[model samples]
Target chain A: MNDTLMTDESRLRREHHKGHYDRETVYRILDENPFCHLAFVQQGQPVVIPTMQWRVGDMVYWHGSSKSRIAHGSDSAKVCLTASRIDGLVLARSAFEHTVNFESVVVIGEAQRFEDTAQKTALLESFFDHLFPGRWDALRAMTASELKATAVMGLPLHSASAKIRRGPPNEPEEDRATPVWGGVLPIAMQFGKPLPDEFNQMPEPGYLARLRTKP
Target chain B: MNDTLMTDESRLRREHHKGHYDRETVYRILDENPFCHLAFVQQGQPVVIPTMQWRVGDMVYWHGSSKSRIAHGSDSAKVCLTASRIDGLVLARSAFEHTVNFESVVVIGEAQRFEDTAQKTALLESFFDHLFPGRWDALRAMTASELKATAVMGLPLHSASAKIRRGPPNEPEEDRATPVWGGVLPIAMQFGKPLPDEFNQMPEPGYLARLRTKP
Candidate 1:
């Protein structure tokens, strides 16, 4: 992997200090977040859609109904995929200095539809495995029509960047002495007790029982 | 206040039943999520920016560095703003039926720069108040250059929609009897312990000490 990735177009244009293009940082944030907002231009205007997305190595993939115009619009198009997780709320002394601690990644690439059913099935299984380990094998195999209705597009993570922020708020020397509470309030994703399906009559998989994400 | 909002441009083309155009649902989702992905066409290709944004009434606001090109790009142009909160992970009996329960809002409109100093100042304070309540007044005031360096843009929510999914996974009868565990793992965002600044010498505010999001 390259030390950094900065194309004429991928370079961070604002707050450059907070910008990072390292492949490791980019890949880590991508893998950690399963949801991403896909941005693509249509008829001179841009649209954003939150969808299920995953990354394998450097290639990113998204799935949707092939019959849907909006979801299928991503097939062979210039798109920007972005995923972000808010780490904490950075409470600076001054309102102007207040910011959020976050890790974000952006990948700009052209995505093409995967016409090969075998490849889509394999990727779909991976998606299940990633989200629900030790359970994919037990589920029934997918039907051809199910595969036909789904559209999977792959975008190589060629041009990407990650912006990460951590630690306490950046309070200037003068404001530090002020009698105001200033610090970082950590925000985390916690999984609660699982609610079984109405007809589910089987024992919980060990992995599903341990599906909680450590905040 | 009406029953539903359906615009030729803003309507959900797929999963039509999941689409909601009611102003109440749209407003509620907007107020609940402070972070939004702003999508707009930048030189033909779309760019998705993870930004701090909030909606007040029908107006949506975003903050950024005024000097930067991408941040300033929203001065006056068509844009799509989207915010989403994941409610739970739907573990389904079938791998193909897996989904995430979430609530998302999308608004399509044109964004204009808030150039007036007074208006910008008020909005900036609102940002702080929304993120950290009972703390804005304790901080020091901003200088003119600080105000000049920041960019605030407002977009009116003219055409919008909210997509919400809740409850457990949609398991059909045939898949329900299978001997595989399937359920809904509720996900939540919780605020962790506050990490004080190195120089902070004041007691934490009531809001910060008991920081929690009611999921």
Candidate 2:
């Protein structure tokens, strides 16, 4: 079972237009994407880093080196977590009118570093399983030292917002008559055939067929 | 003619990794996606915002209010820009081993706001045309005062990094022996029929067909 459920909100404002507080849309996007961009400052300089992340309910978690410049010595802080999925390319007759349809989430809140052993262990398990299910359980549990060395942080979706733009171009009236190519270039993410890691010993049957039946 | 070119070494480093740096691969992902996540700090806290962006050669530009919290009063000076594409979902025989294949870029650098009249005018033209070509030239130019009110910023592709995880699950030797299902769930982005703005009067062919040719 995954903890990445979305919290519900009924009164989403217009500016916050696509801000979905619903679990269905939120979890669907979160689960389909594995990486997220995190922004924070170090010594007054803004820096953005890309890292693997897992979502638990409305909260997101990620890890980095404790000695890293951005997280190591900073005071308690709030940072932004964003996940976006690009749907298509919007080409207009005029070069100036291109646009794209997309879905994205912006989370603004404080991130709390996980220090306790029990919580860290649980989070690690949740994260690993979230990334590669059952792998965590099959592997040896994290030793006390490994847990101590890793830095894990969690940020809640307090000021969370999501934006999505879809469909075609909104060209001006008369300009539509201009002779130019216009339309969407649909794009997709497709999976290549799976290759087993070198360390794997067993000659197993393909797993691709299995994934379809389960989800 | 596109302004978003990636040439800075640092930006390239931050964006290109061993398995993900091929130009054809990078550009394929870049041209197809429309939205990016901007990470910055406000009042000692990190805030991530989702916004529309365009790539023109090496530089990526984003626009917003001059008095906005994340941009106008940003403390770190530099900002982090990230874009990610989720290719497919992985479902392994074991529930704990699910994963996804993805491509992503993390950009780190200082953002210089556009203030010069000439630069602002050019940038605005690029911005407008980048989103909707020919529209800038066709529409009335922004008055001096109107230009003064808009804020634009440029972040070089310096100190960037790109990390990508692709292909299928690396199932454990033991799990491979299990009969449970496993495989990938592909994700794609496609454009729907274009919708003209209610206010748009003269309907030319519209911009949908032109965008369809994008990779």
Candidate 3:
């Protein structure tokens, strides 16, 4: 994708050096993070809702209850979806220079709902398979009524940008000599041992090992 | 706060049982999560940006570079601020019953900038004190230039609501008997060992211990 195609809104205004318009950087962040916060206009006011999101090729998809306001309001409307992962906290010698190491992507596009049940079901299956590998085939199949009550919306990844910050804190040369203990405290999301429900009778699936390997 | 004062826009249209308008629930979620995604209308389009936020009494505040669009665009505008923490992944016998256990708050209000340097400076100081306890005083004082380059905005918590989902997944009785391993995979954010910067010598502060105890 050409960098020029990226809109000015998607570009990072303050820290331009941290902005990335390339597909590789943008897609990597989106693929690694499954949760996203979606923003859209509702009754002339901005509203944001957190939901699970998955990406297929150049499109990003999210699902919600068919009767939910988010699904209805975002369909065919311009919206912004952001996914971020905090990697660490940078402690600087001074409070003003303190920041967090993170990777975030902002995608601005027109959201369109997948009205076709067959296509939506396929996408939903892909989502489960993508996150849990072989788990989709292990569970009971989705009923038509269940599928009918879900709304799946997709947005093209045409206007997307990634902003990333890593490594040590950026401090002034003078402050670096100060006797303050400045450094980075790494942060990560970890999955605990599988907790089986009371009614469950089967052993934990091998696909769960994938969660431990996720970035 | 009177429940009737909450506008229809702020009320949850579906699954009302999971919605909470009480101050205790809303404030607790806001206080627990420091990161938030702020949404506001910009140039007739919705924009969402992730930022670090802090809560003080009845309001939530966030700071950004003075020159950043988010700082300017959000000032005096109707915005939505959301903070969420994912506790676990709920695996059900059927795909349709899968969900996540999380605590989230959505606050809708007008954002106003704190223009006075002294007030903004004090608020910024409190933010550090709130997050790091006594570390604010150990760092170098904020310079006048740094103060002028930052913009701080606050929004009232009157129009906020918290949505919490916890415990086991809700599955059909028949599906519960399926031989599929159904349970919750607990998810948590962990802080790793701190890495000190290559600077002058100073022992790691006692405040670092507080990070490990955070929820």
Candidate 4:
């Protein structure tokens, strides 16, 4: 198995017990979360933007409006990509011990922009198709002008690491018998319901309907 | 009465239609999301760390291990604080039109650390109590070492703006009739069943039980 190779940047320095290194763990977090915060330096100040990302093979893809600052500045620049889900709120028996149980992956790499128009066009279609098979075929094709206005970028996932914390509240043995409450409250992200467009006369896609429970 | 003041840094340059200003919308999004991505520059490179935060009046507070790099590096640094929730994945009829419906707030400011031990301890309690009333009182008292080992940082919410996109997919009329499916899928974050610690024997707190349905 090809494991994730940790670099100086990907290594964890604090609470090292929470660090994780393995392709299996990294991909699991990425596949489970569709949103991520992409961080990069701009004019010597750090800026982080939340965006939708898709993973295909060993590469992760993200796209936005051509006019967006991230679309223009992040390409070819060293960046940190982080996708994290708060699993639970760790309510402890001591104030200082309270913490959050979460799963996070941080990847450092250079973002590469798609140079070929056809490559960009095909990848964009794949982005939608990945969510629901045959869904892209039902939508109209992107026009020349439409494709020109979108910027598609990708980064290799070769340098990445996942960090996670999941457990019951950890408190000193002396503090355990305190009269206060202590435990973990689990959190989940779910899909509510799909609202079809008013003009639409099609049955809710089986895939979309299924998300109500699975999403 | 008093709304957040807008500055050049907090203003949106693209998709002006999606930008929202004022206290009502900004606080609504901030209060709902349990965690936020803290962005700061490190040695000229950008880094984004996810952490839990609490909003108290005009200030937002967060805490983590004192040994963490962010604890030391974020202080006095001009940082971009962002809290976002991905509402749903927008499945558009065109590749370029595909977008995720979300609500996000970005605030740019310098992070200031609480140097006073008592102040830090008090805020830490408030952070927990805000999540669950009387949560801090139920827990045992924090020791000196515990308070010293955590860093509490704050940023004012004076200059913040929320960006949101909701409702059905927006597509060109010409493309609407395509055989493909197009609509909005709603995403919701909620609390799951609480997992009590092995030693926990107190009646499950009503607040904790209500979260299973509300969180």
Cα lDDT tens digits for candidate 2, A1-215: 33332333222334355566555676567666556777776556555655667888767887765555344654457566767666666655454455566776666667888888898878878876665465555554455665666788888755555567777775666656654444555554444444554344444333343433332
List model 4 lDDT by residue over B123-181, tens digit each: 98788776787777777677788888888988888778899998788877877777666
Worst 10 residues of 2 chain B by lDDT: B9-18
Q: Pick the candidate with the highest lDDT.
A: 3
Error of 3 at A131 (Å): 0.7
Clashes of each: 0, 70, 0, 5
The 10-residue segment of model 3 chain A with minimum total lDDT is A1-10
What's the true lDDT of residue A143 in model 2?
55
Q: Which segments of candidate 4 are over 4 A away from where they belong?
A: A74-76, A213-215, B74-76, B213-215
Q: Kindly list the per-residue Cα lDDT of model 4 for residues A1-215, writing each as its tens digit.
A: 25655777778887788888787788778877768998877665667889877788788888888888777754238777888988898877778777789999887777887867899988877776767767777776778888888888887987787888989987778877877677888888888777777777777888776656663
Measured with C-alpha atoms, the lDDT of residue A55 in candidate 4 is: 81
Docking class of 1: medium
Score candidate 1 by TM-score against the native: 0.95
Q: Considering every candidate listed, which one attains the maximal DockQ?
A: 3
Estimate, for each residue in A1-215, the C-alpha lDDT of model 1 and write its tens digit.
55676776789876789898888888888888887898877666678888877888778888888886534554238888999888888888777788888888888877778979999998887777777776778888888988998888878877888888888887668888878887888888778888887777877677756667443
Better of 1 and 3 by DockQ: 3
Residue A197 miss distance in model 4 (angstroms): 1.6
Note the DockQ of each predicted structure. 0.77, 0.25, 0.81, 0.71
Show pairs that collide, candidate 3: none
Q: What TM-scores result for chain A when each predicted structure is judged separately against the true chain A? A: 0.93, 0.79, 0.94, 0.93
The pairs that clash in candidate 4 are A138-B180, A139-B180, A180-B138, B190-B215, B191-B215
